[model samples]
Target: MELNSAKPGLLCSLEASQSQRTMYPYVTGTSVVALKYKDGILMAADMGGSYGSTLRYKSVERMKPIGKHCLIGASGEISDFQEVLRYLDELTLNDKMCDDGNSLGPKEIHSYLTRVMYNRRNKFDPLWNSLVLGGVKNGQTYLGMVTMIGVNFEDNHIATGFGNHLARPILRDEWREDLSFEDGVKLLEKCMRVLLYRDRSAVNKLQIANITEEGVTISQPYSLRTFWGFSAFINPTPGAQ
Candidate 1:
């Protein structure tokens, strides 16, 4: 008897075919929180990346300064976010080469990212990230978000991943049109703290990027003050990360 040799060959062929078809995320980040403030825009994200359920890497930066008038924060596959950054670096480099005395602002960067993401989606090999973009252009605060499938929209405030679920409600209630830089930082920290408690992938350390007419200022990585002592934990507490 041949012992059904053809079945094994078929299974191996299917596995190989699937593996060659696309780039899948391995290590990924969790959420990004951002909003427009009185001066410009503030964006925040943690320095952690997860390998599946394991918190695999710390000190992974999820935010970057883009051009002169823009900052970008990402949640989802870490490598995919790096790839997107390379694309933007090229875009900005090309703009600088033109010497037209004009630079790509946040809105332009967001639109370009929309096209890149949509094009990748059509290829069925999307970048696997939800990105938050913010900046100040000629005193206008622009904040927008783009997803892996090319869906994009602008709002006064935005959050991705767990943040969309946990942090946006706080932003809606307390975010103000005249939010000073100090107040904005406090608000973002408050949001991140909530996520750290609820989100399994969230890390204690994070960064906040501030973009304004003057330029961009990304703060050094810092950890938030957290409280883990509560009577609720004795009975299997809520969000005990």
Candidate 2:
């Protein structure tokens, strides 16, 4: 009777393992940064994927154009991120085939992705990524973020992963609504430089994309200028053999 509720070992009862009930990411990217300037939105991400503590992929492209006006950037499981892109690709294709001339905007794409990530989490299987969506539609700029848990918010500027920790502070102090495209890029570079110096998972090679009323343009991968003359970086063992 009450023995059914007893401990498993005493009754020789075999308990099933809950190993597959959750998700754990293997290869993951670090962070993504997005901001809104006068003309439109801008985003940046580095090309690096880490396996545990080991560096795995170095040329991964985390920021991508969605539809015609929006750009999406992700920081997390690289494979899962790619799967999200496939979903968007299909969605965009379907919209094109409909010939409605009404494409999915940044807000719409972000909302759709939020649903996807949340649904997967509810199933005990999550995508393990933080996403940034940016675009310019109807002469208005949009910037938003969604986490693996489906948490989301919009702001003039948004960043994911390490960017949230190390870059947001800088952005909060510097980002402005009417920032020029040149200034926006410089600001993003400042944040990325800090990340490159502080975040071990971050790489120096990065891509910056901007979406104006015209369209989206992602820059070629480039590295930032770094100085290692500081004492902390110069010598860990000043007098040691």
Q: Which candidate is the best by lDDT?
A: 1
Error of 1 at 170 (Å): 0.5
The per-prediction tally of clashing pairs is 0, 0
> In order, what lDDT does every prediction score?
0.92, 0.88
Please give each candidate's TM-score.
0.90, 0.87
In terms of lDDT, the poorest run of 10 residues in model 1 is 1-10
Residue 60, candidate 2: alpha-carbon lDDT:
91
- TM-score of model number 2: 0.87
CA error at residue 197 for candidate 2, angstroms: 0.7
